[model samples]
Target: MLIGALLILTWLILLIRYPAKALPVSGAALIGLLLVGAWMYWLDTREARQLAHLELRLDYAPTRCPADRPLALTLKNGGGSPLQELRWRIAAYAPGDSVNLVETLYDAPRYRGPGELLPGDTWHDCLPLPPFRPGYRPDTLEFRAERLQGSFAD
Candidate 1:
């Protein structure tokens, strides 16, 4: 944005100072602004586009630990990039309830897999869930991928 503002300011100054060269200078500035806009759009949508190709499934394994129910996650990276970081949201809801009973956000700097999840790879692991209110049990749980940042491997 700063670069775009500077380009516009520079174009305006050139137009006022050198009327003869205004046309060519303004054309070049326009091209620079368009290039900046394209780069910004790509940066803004890259994460969302990658996230769309990811699939997540969540289940509870109560028998595995009688005290604290562990969450079982199966993530499939269908995108063309190697996933490095993930932040997701978990929401607990009662049956037929529109409002959520409880919600929590989890950030995993490194996912618990063999390594960075590669494209077309699936990772399955058990993770500890955040504690809910005492005696407040939810019937259904919802999962959403809040952020998925990754890069393509060379």
Candidate 2:
């Protein structure tokens, strides 16, 4: 796209420098600009389609677990495109007092590999929970997928 713009700019400069050659230069510049616009539109549409077809499903096992037990989850791609990477945050919460404030036993984002995730692919692994001090019992698990990436053309 940048190259196309530079070429158009150079053509315009030449057109200004040579008034007699305006007709041919203008015709070529118009065609170049139209082709660039069409290419950009195609690229944009392809990206939108890819994003629309990308989906992720995270299934956590033993939502309530002892602090000593490892947290496990299965990540599945249930879409048409292959996923490149995914980042998410998981938190362990204890029972709240009067439903106003809950004790946070653990809270952090876990970074996962950019491994290829084809449609219907499932990746299972245990998440390393952060060490917690005493007086915290994990009663509930919270999960949020923060970012996602799909495959791109090289």
Candidate 3:
């Protein structure tokens, strides 16, 4: 879909650039379309895998301060190549309500972290949750991971 769209767009641009006397319509447009399509297609990595193998748990559901309330998430990569970035959307469900948060690796690239999802690789992240109250007995804490667009192989 991406390549096809680019090809059509390029052809349109080339048609506008060519002069009336140059050709019947636009020869340059045809060439431009092919070139752009090839470039975009070249970026597709066929061997890439798309899936999330994650293990989330309340490491320490303390009824105290944020530092003391420990929430850890372990992500394991069971794919062929390394994932560029892993974005996580975590939701915590308590007795009668729930709250969700988006977590991403932070360090180098834009919204990317130092962690790379390598084959058979595991990354452990410690999330700080709002301190749980003593009176509230949480029902369940659930989490889902969303891999960034360019992170997965084509």
Candidate 4:
């Protein structure tokens, strides 16, 4: 933005330098438009995008029940493009047969990832997930991935 402002100032200065001592109105307008266009083009080229098959793993790294349980998740941006500070929410569900109902899980840790992940690289995140409901035991767990503004095209 600062550079854009400076360019505009320069253009205005040129226009005032020679009211009718030089160039035509169309010529000046063309130059100003080109400058702004070039700036926008550079920004678009650097903007991050989402590529497919970005692997994400959520696992029960370790658990002791009702006391101190730490959940670890790995986000691998395996695609070619690097994703920005994308807002995504992940929820993990232990099978209903796992924990007890008395343990009310009301909140979980929410965070924002800031590193630039290259292809084949992994980003690790540790979240304090809600306590697992007590029960017999869980055979399978399910997780859902949600993004604030879905796809870039959409």
Q: What's the TM for model 3?
A: 0.44
> Which candidate has the top score in TM-score?
1
lDDT of 4 by residue, 66-148 (tens): 22435566777666665555455655555653323223434544545545666677887665554445552322555444453
Any runs in candidate 3 off by more than 4 Å, and if so which?
1-27, 34-69, 91-114, 130-139, 147-154
Lowest-sum lDDT 10-residue window in model 3: 105-114
Sort order, lDDT high to low: 1, 2, 4, 3
Q: What local lDDT does model 1 show for residue 33?
A: 100
* lDDT for position 80 in model 4: 61
- Please estimate how well model 1 matches the true structure, expressed as its whole-model Cα lDDT: 0.66
**What are the per-residue Cα lDDT tens digits for candidate 1 across 6-97?**
98898788889997889886788789999999999987688678878888876666555344446777889899888876665555555566
Q: Give the TM-score of candidate 2.
A: 0.45
lDDT (tens digit, per residue) of candidate 2 on 1-154: 9999998798778878886888786888789999999999998787667655544333334554344445665676666667775554443433343221222343533456447777777776656554333554333534333344345432
Alpha-carbon lDDT, every model: 0.66, 0.57, 0.50, 0.55
Candidate 1 stretches with Cα past 4 Å from truth are: 1-14, 43-46, 65-69, 103-115, 131-135, 138-140, 152-154
- How many times do residue backbones clash in model 4? 6
Tell me how many residue pairs clash in candidate 3. Answer: 2
Query: How well is each residue in 1-154 modelled by candidate 3, as lDDT tens digits?
Result: 9999997787667657765644554667568899999877765434222543333334433333255335555666666667666553434444344443322334312322325666677776555544333454333544333333436533
Model 4 stretches with alpha carbons more than 4 Å out: 1-51, 63-69, 94-108, 131-140, 148-154
Error of 1 at 150 (Å): 4.0
